[model samples]
Structure formats: structure tokens, C-alpha cells
Target: MTALIMLVFSLASLFMFPLMAQPLSLGLAIMISTLLMCSLASMMLSSWYGYILFLIYVGGLLVMFAYVAALSPNTLFGSGSPLLFFSALLVPLSLILYLYPLKDFSLMTVLSDYSGFMYLKSYGSELISPDSMSILIGLGTILLLNLIVVVKICYYQHASLRPFNEV
Candidate 1:
């Protein structure tokens, strides 16, 4: 199934994280993995959700790329070990997947049915329904806590992330 292939590619890309030596390479790897994940999400859920998720990830990655480009020195890319390793790992994974088959792994079956289509349509609304108010409140509280923590950290006069003032 497409989802299985995406999952395998995502895992393979993630495995390269530890092998990355440069900030740029790491960022590139992260972007690739995020893309695969978003594609998988699109297949399993709604396309709109995956599109939004990918946009958010791209925004974050842009910020990260800017920071790394500014703070890190330009370094030549390392040898092709990562690619070789990735290819090596992918072959075995593909072999295993081919050898051991899975049943009903594709979301196309669910999407093909009218009830399933309706369920998917209502899935978004269910999240914010009255019954899930507690979950929303909890998420809000967590975000508030995170904001407070970030503000506290950034408020320090000598914080590295603080904006520079023109002398």
C-alpha cells in the first residue's frame, strides 16, 4: 500500500538523523521526513489536514534553516555514507515488506464506503464538540504553559535569542 511505502520511507529518513553531521543536512533530512509523514497523513486522513501540517512544518523549517545558515559555518558535505546506508537499509525493508504481506492496510477501502466518508467528514467536528471540551481546555493550558516558559526564557537580558539593538 502507499501508506506502507510512505511509512517505510519515513522510517528510513528518520534513521539518517543520527548520521547527519552538518546542520543543513540535518534540516534537509527533517524536511524529507516531515514531507513523507504529511503524505501518509493525507492518505489516512483528510488532504486539507496534511496540507496545513506541511505548511506549518515548512514555516518551522524555514526558521530553523535561517538560524542554522546564520550561526553555522559553511561546511562541505560529507561522504556518501548516509546515502549508501539508506539504500542498504531500504532494500532489506522492502524485501521484508514484500515477503510478509499485510491485509486491509490501505485507507482506500474505508474512503470508498459512504459511512466511512461521512465519518471522516465529521471527524474534525468531533474534536471540538461539547464532549471534548476538557481535551481542548487541557491543550490550551499546555500551550499557555509553553508560552509562559518561552517568555520567561527570552526575557533574560542576555538571552542569545534576544533581538539585537542598533548601537
Candidate 2:
């Protein structure tokens, strides 16, 4: 029940983010906050696997934030340059990394994933670039996976506690 509520709230916030009239910075802040809250909640409610996934998501957000902060807005989308190409390539790569986390998805994977997206859209344009969209979709997939793990854990825990319930 708690997991369901949290999932609903996070999904609602994620969708509602774009409809507000706030500045881009404010939107970023909201995204960070929402991500943090969801990550923490998942960590608390989930098993080891779910916790690891949440950590990866949190790490990705931080990295993306840093990359966006470090780059000059002009260079991000100025022209056909190496940085743009690298950033573009990084998006899919990060997604791949996130999906197949090495040694358990930690902060590093999260940071790399997010950073790649930010680098792709460092310019002062819209935030919803192709990379960003991919990231979002990836996140949604992770969330679903985490939820499944949580459900499985809950089922096993309950089963162990009430072995005779089936009878």
C-alpha cells in the first residue's frame, strides 16, 4: 500500500512538473526534490535490489545536475560540434549502463546517466530534449522494476510470516 501511494505521488509530480509556469531553475529544483523523495522512499520500502536501483537513480540526477551547472549554455547547442555529438551519444550509453548496472548501480551510474543528458542540452533551450526524454523513459522502467521487486519481497515476507494462510 505504501509503495503504491508513493508511486502514484511520484508519477503525478513527474507529470505535473512541465505544466507549471515556473522558471527552468525552479523546475530543476522540483525535479531534484521529487527524485530524492522517491529514491529515499524506494530505498526504505524496498529490498536490497530495489535499494540499489534507487541509489542509481539518485546518483544519475546528481551527475546530470552538475553537468548542466558546469557547462556554458551557448556551447551546448551552438552548432555541430564534438561536444554535442559526444553528449548525444552519451544519452543512449547511459541508458544502457543504467539498465545493466555493474557491481550494483550506485551513485556513479546515476551521475553518468544524468550528466550525459545534461551535456546534451546545456544550451538555454527547452529541457525536454531527446536525451532527456530517454532518461525519463529509462527512469520509468527502473521504477517499474523496483516496484516489482518490492511486491515480490512483500509477498515472500508475508508468506513466511503466515505459512498456514494458504490452508
In terms of lDDT, which candidate is strongest? 1
What does candidate 1's lDDT look like per residue over 16-64, in tens digits?
A: 6667656677777777877887776565556887789789878976876
Residue 36 of model 2: what lDDT?
A: 48
Among all windows of 10 consecutive residues in model 2, the one with the lowest summed lDDT is 71-80
lDDT of 2 at 113: 58
Error of 2 at 72 (Å): 6.6
Off by over 4 Å in 1: 98-108, 111-117, 125-167
lDDT, model 2: 0.42
C-alpha local distance difference test of each model: 0.62, 0.42
RMSD of each: 8.4, 22.8
- Colliding residue pairs in candidate 2: 59-110, 59-111, 60-110, 60-111, 64-114
Best by TM-score: 1
Report the C-alpha lDDT of model 2 over 1-167, residue by residue, as the tens digit.
Answer: 33333434444444333332222342353454356445533443224434565577667656644543333122222233423444454455555554664332243235345665455335523224332343345466545544343343334433324345453
- Please identify model 2 stretches exceeding 4 Å from their true place: 19-46, 72-138, 141-167
TM-score of each: 0.64, 0.32
